[model samples]
Target: MPTDDMTARPTTSREDGLAAEVRTLLRTGLPIRLAAGPRLLGLRGVQARARRPDDPSSLARALDGLLREQLDRLENTGLAEASRLLFGAEAATSGATLTARRQAAADASGYEVHHFRKRIEPKLIDLVAWQLRRDSDTFMARHATAPELRAATRPLVLPADVFAWEAVEHQHALARLWGAVYLLRAELLTTARLASMDAPATETDAAATRALWRHALVLAAAAEYRAAYGAALLDRAGDTDLGPDQIAAYAGWTPPLSPAADLILVRLADPDGSLADFTARLDAARGGSELTADWRRALSGRDRDTDPNTLPAAAPEGSTP
Candidate 1:
């Protein structure tokens, strides 16, 4: 009945170990799924046979665990925050309509124009990035040794302001990449489910995702502090070469769960005050940082067309490695 009771009264080592694992997975997985009733009870039965050599309980349970883990992660990490951000008053009232929001900037003043360059933009990007960084922490907490967490933490630092800046930038960048990636992931999941109807997602899809993935990877690699890695990833992603395969890999894209959506929605909701308010918020969030450095350099007669020789070659444009 109770978790401790089951493990404490274990029948055999193999059974005990299996039961413990099943419980661990359920404890973690169920919460992630917000599971109740049937799913929970169903897993219990699966757990029972996990120790039976004749039963495929262990493998089946592992699959369920994996699926549940992914589902839970989707719920807990990004989707959760997205709800708040998107529906929040601010994002809902921004000056731009969905049509306008989707339109090209055409000029330098509309909400569509320089959305990426706006100070608020990067703040939102960094907000999501930080949340992601935190998610990484939770993932590591379960498996990381003490020293590892300490060492890992070294690279994640950001002046709260700077971290916040990249958070906004990355969020928009991700949005650009999201629609395409979701379509791909949906197709992959569908095919995986109906193998007879369709082919499984191929290595090509994985390759297509290289640009976005590599951008994220590079940011993680270049961060001044461990925590900043996520920020770095978001900021540098724009520079990465996008390709077909890299595009396909991003099919699983989902809105990040963070305060970002709230900001966007807030701006959307208050057509009158959204810009002014968002601008003020952006300034508050921007504590001192070199955030505008790249953009500044771009504006100061620096060639956007030429990659800086000082900076390492950006992964051969679209090459993943």
Candidate 2:
């Protein structure tokens, strides 16, 4: 007697159907764990190879590695490196540099610098989030884990080591978000720590000037609007002291945030000139450039941006749109 048997290869329709279903699930932002081997394999293949749908796993892994590297850099690298291109680390932080402080803290706490949750701000959080969004697939994979998602929204104070082991998703969006927050907070804390040292900044040279400007850009990207302004004030003068041209450059480097911008202007205001005249000179020095009016509201103590009623009582003399 012959056994009844059917052997047939999987059809094209079956493969196409599977691909379509996988795409739909990915669009919904579900976890890969919910997927079958075929789907996961396809997704991974697409992502790992940089094909369409851009593998979530690949993106996740990339972000994970980047975060890890950043933490390591923060730990192993000295403040001199971290501070080199940004604010004049030595001057801004007094004689002590970022490397020194991290080392000091590490020594005192008996924990690796990477183990502590560094103080950071929301702006950095935004930056990290923006970066994570660039790798959509990785973000989706990390999103699959509920605990990881929650952890991201509310970051932990512990260092990278504790979380590294739990590696739920590489380039975890939640992790990246939290890491950004940590970085921003740490920078602010570091700045404050430096300020509390209470030593007048040493005479900053041209090298320091360039560093401070670079720092200003980093702060701007992190949305440390105030810090960006503060860095400008701290480095406003050269080794020779505040000159006419240098002062103008400081004003132009002001962050786009109105409140922050006003603070810089206030800090850099010439003793002999009125605010109006000061701003005019600033404009002249910068070839008639104007600070956007919207930022003016930040100076006036309004929490929100400038609106119709919030317009300056009158534009400063010599002001142009």
Candidate 3:
């Protein structure tokens, strides 16, 4: 799991900051849904029969290891100190809600809003619970000397008194927290992925998971969507297409376990192969990306006019993508 920073640092394709970093990790890394246990176990069984065997755990395990690597980078980068100052007090509070304490911790640590929105958005009672389990006096002592800890709790400094690096340092902590939080989700999702990784999950479950994830991915990839993706996707999907349990699984990090589900999503996203005449014709003319754009824009919380440039020529104003 050890990585040489100078050598192993990713040659990132863009500098769009934390959002891009997280998205890249999500896309390039193992789906997290197939991280371990029976599913991975079955994969090993499949590989034994093939001439060109694949190491499934390279993704299932290594991606998780990568997440931890990112977390260590954060802690060593001074996020641990940031946590000590910003969240030390309230995190040690006897009766505070875990949610409030987590927000305080994340805020104090300097996590950016965008980073929080994308990577650290999941449930995080574990971090707060870890903090709360500390002895009260020990908790207070660790943060007692950190001036920013007090400064964040109070409004002592003028705007001009603060330097940009201090803000940057705080923001740096957020990136660390985001990766760490994802590891937690990875653990949970992998469990579910491992569970449903078998034949136990119904065919309907796979169908629903694939539909929802594809819709969500399209919206997440597109920039023009102004409304909530959830409301839009659900509005279009029926109870049969996206079950409540499937929704929870997807949200929690469970990947669609079905090979059929995986293939369905990939084919839809890529828009190739045996298709209806109009659909194939549309792909041929406007390009597969444009059709995806139409679908993504169509599935929004509120109905809005689609950008003409982004959609295929035949994609009518209000029609589903």
| Candidate number achieving the greatest TM-score relative to the actual structure | 2
- Candidate 3 lDDT for residue 58: 44
TM for candidate 1 is 0.17
Q: What C-alpha lDDT values do all the predictions have?
A: 0.31, 0.32, 0.33
Q: Which regions in candidate 2 have their CA more than 4 angstroms from the true location?
A: 1-45, 51-216, 219-289, 299-321
What lDDT does candidate 2 reach at residue 114?
Answer: 59
Determine the backbone clash count of candidate 3. 2
Can you write out model 3's per-residue Cα lDDT over 4-118, one digit (the tens) per residue?
Answer: 1222222322222322333333332223435343322222222332222245554445434433333333422434433222222222522344344445545654676445434
Segments in model 3 whose C-alpha atoms lie over 4 Å from true places? 1-11, 15-21, 24-31, 35-53, 80-105, 108-321
In model 1, the number of clashes is 54
lDDT of 2: 0.32
In model 1, what is the error at residue 38, expressed in angstroms? Answer: 46
How many pairs of residues collide in each model?
Answer: 54, 17, 2
The better-scoring model by TM-score among 2 and 3 is 2
